[model samples]
Target chain A: MVITPQRNIVSRTWGTSVGKKSVIAVTGIVFLLYVIAHMIGNLKVFFGIETFDAYSQHLREIGEAIFGYEGVLWGIRAVLVGSVVLHMWAAFSLWYQAKKARPIGYQHRQRWEGSYAARTMRWGGVIIALFVIWHILDLTTGTVNPLGGDESAYLKLVASFDRWYVALFYILAVVALGLHIRHGLWSAIQTFGANSALKQNALKTFAFVVAAVITIGFAIVPLSVMTGLVR
Target chain B: MKLTLRIWRQASPEAKGKMQKYTLDDVEPDMSFLEMLDVLNEKLVLDDKDPVSFDHDCREGICGSCGMVINGNAHGPQKFTTTCQLHMRHFNDGDTIDIEPWRAKAFPVVKDLVVDRSAFDEIIKSGGYISVNTGSAPEAHAIPVDKVSADDAFDAATCIGCGACVAACPNGSSMLFTAAKVTHLGLLPQGQPERATRAINMLATQDELDFGGCTNVGACHEVCPKGIPLASIAQLNHDVLGATLTGARSD
Candidate 1:
């Protein structure tokens, strides 16, 4: 395939504010869906070690006949990684633009009294990104898992959460992720052009509830383990 | 009412601006904000001092020329009101108000309380002109429009290009202004042929002019003089994506 060197419509728009934001909106939805799914899978730990461990192994076995061993799992990982790269790229680009546009701020720049979640979107995103790395090391790859990679998924989770510091960190990261979602979900709704006067209230409520649900769902596991409810 | 006013003073575009204080007595509650400024200017004239320079054209709030940050909020504390129409009644007797130019890199200060806003014109020009045949006036009923779109277009057409949205936005974004134009034209039958290119060029130019990226802070919507809704930005975003997917060519 010969790629034309000349600037085309696609290339021009891709570097623009609309282009970058559209990208963020699309990738953000992917993460949103993935987190909800991951939370539901984690809740399976309540069903006992056997069922939870079975679920973890089942992720690798999905579509075994058609895609071969671990193919579907790898595919999911590929999409997630791609989403992360695009999401961060667009987010940083927007951040740089915003910073450049307002070199001189107001002497008494009255805060718009925006939601705390909206105000902390950038820093919250950074915290969430860092947490993703730690989470992958501890749970997915088991490189830092105290119980080791060879142990059952349930045991690995329990062992990681059994440490008070690890559990506290998990709760902190979960809250940051939730706040990120609270702002991001509504921003995505606007970017997609689905927001309007009539639907604004309902959609705002929906975004808040979804963010709250995801935060609680993830945080509960670490709390349960620390409290000895899931040991 | 006696009030202390802290106004930004910049002699030239290259000069370092600073806040200077002035005491304004005999400020009547019925006097418009600009009228109060006139009283202050008269006092300066008698003192043989250079008067404070600000932008104002139509004091009735129709013209887009008058805009400044009053006490950190764009167009002062009133809702759906312009600085030209903001009366003195809103302020307390002894209130100390801070007045400054719109502080965005895209909008540079020209003098005291006045900033260069031609960047908005550049963004408007890049959107390209509508293709209308030059001839006698066409019949009114020749091209019919539905009521909903017509009303929506009119609602968007109310934008006066005052730059209040930029002053109000945390990101210094001009999306609301660009969105108003795109939505006004996009909703009409005459705007169809160039709709895609309009969205692409206008948005691209807005970015090129060094305006900030919009994060949907909702401040712009709240402080808008004409009450332009945040949904107009959504509509503009919708048009942009729709245009891109169709492989529309740009100039």
Candidate 2:
């Protein structure tokens, strides 16, 4: 195809806007896959504190051992932190841009015709972001957790879930994460350019299943702890 | 039926525009929306007032020239129907309708409801076409395409390049529109030669126009005159990514 200078300028600028979605979609898929993996990992809690704590400790021991310190877990955490920041930044930027593009208000109220997954993405994203911060502070950093009262990771987890609010927050966050993942998964595939309707619908259905697994799998941990099944 | 319309009016590309109210009485319910506007324009012309400027050629809806925000929807409330095909019966007597041009920074208002949608043309120009051979027409049946694939491609090809998807998008995302075209040509046998580069360059053009990202709002599909599915957007994304990764360079 023949390319002109004016066309070049137009593509260079306009293409950048559409191009950002590609990055967002790619990174979102990475985060969602990580979520699925994390949910499966969290399922260790049901096997009892020994298995869960051992698994957590094992994760903590995996990168570079600095002066006899195994920095593997820290390295993984760093990578995860970077992914989280990138995902959130991309999401917020798109959100801000979308907000600016809309008219102040519709002359007549526009009814939303989108699916539940797409509709709640923004809200679900916000809740998940907040939950991540709380989760890291409570478990990873041991900063504000009630159960970390004695620095016993297993006991801390058990005690934390004992609280109705803490348990509820975790459950609620997982649900929100579920919604975010369900939409994000297929959307990421769309961004990646999956064109076949059969493939698209399959991805959508697969995303729903993943979301269900994450929601139920993560919930199992807290629910088990709350009900004394883990004890 | 009688209805009040707040139509956007602008004298030139540089002129600031706003919604100006006009009342049309005894409007036939069977009249197309644009026809109703035409009736209103005749009244304005008779009154020695400048008629509202818009674009239209083929009134049958294939041309995609007519598009306006009707009560906050592009191409009005009907699904898979263009503005010219929209009937006035959708509105009730005494209804106050707000009509405006398709809003997008890339699609600047040329005059009144007629915005310069040339940005789409530019995007397509960037890489939308196939580099087919120049020779006698090939037998249509020569390309042994799977019926399912052919059907899907045809559906994507139905997109008329009306800026409705962008206009209806909260982010002004043109993903659906762009994707429809890219997927339409990309899925076909004829499009294979330029497929990789086409996806890349076309996407580059899409972003350059200051269009917003697709958050999968599905509004584009909802407002699409041809009912272009959101799946095409996904297809576009997939093709772009594949193109970008494979380093498919077109000579």
TM-score of chain A of 1: 0.94
TM-score, predicted candidate 1 vs. hidden true structure: 0.95
What is the two-chain DockQ of model 2?
0.38
lDDT, residue B172, candidate 2: 78
- Per-prediction TM-score to the true structure, in the order listed: 0.95, 0.86
Model 2 TM-score on a 0 to 1 scale: 0.86
Candidate closest to the true structure, highest TM-score = 1
Q: Write the per-residue lDDT of candidate 2 for residues B1-251, one digit (tens) a residue.
A: 98998988888888866779999887999999989988999999999999988888899999888898888888888888999999988889999999988888788888888988888998889777887679999998998998877988999888888889988886777888788888889888888888877877776666656776778878888898888888887777677666555555555
Instruction: Compose the digit string of candidate 2's lDDT tens values, residues A101-145.
Output: 554434554554477778888778888888989988887666777
Question: Considering every candidate listed, which one attains the maximal lDDT?
Answer: 1
Tens-place lDDT digits, model 1, residues A96-127: 99999989889876656368898888888988
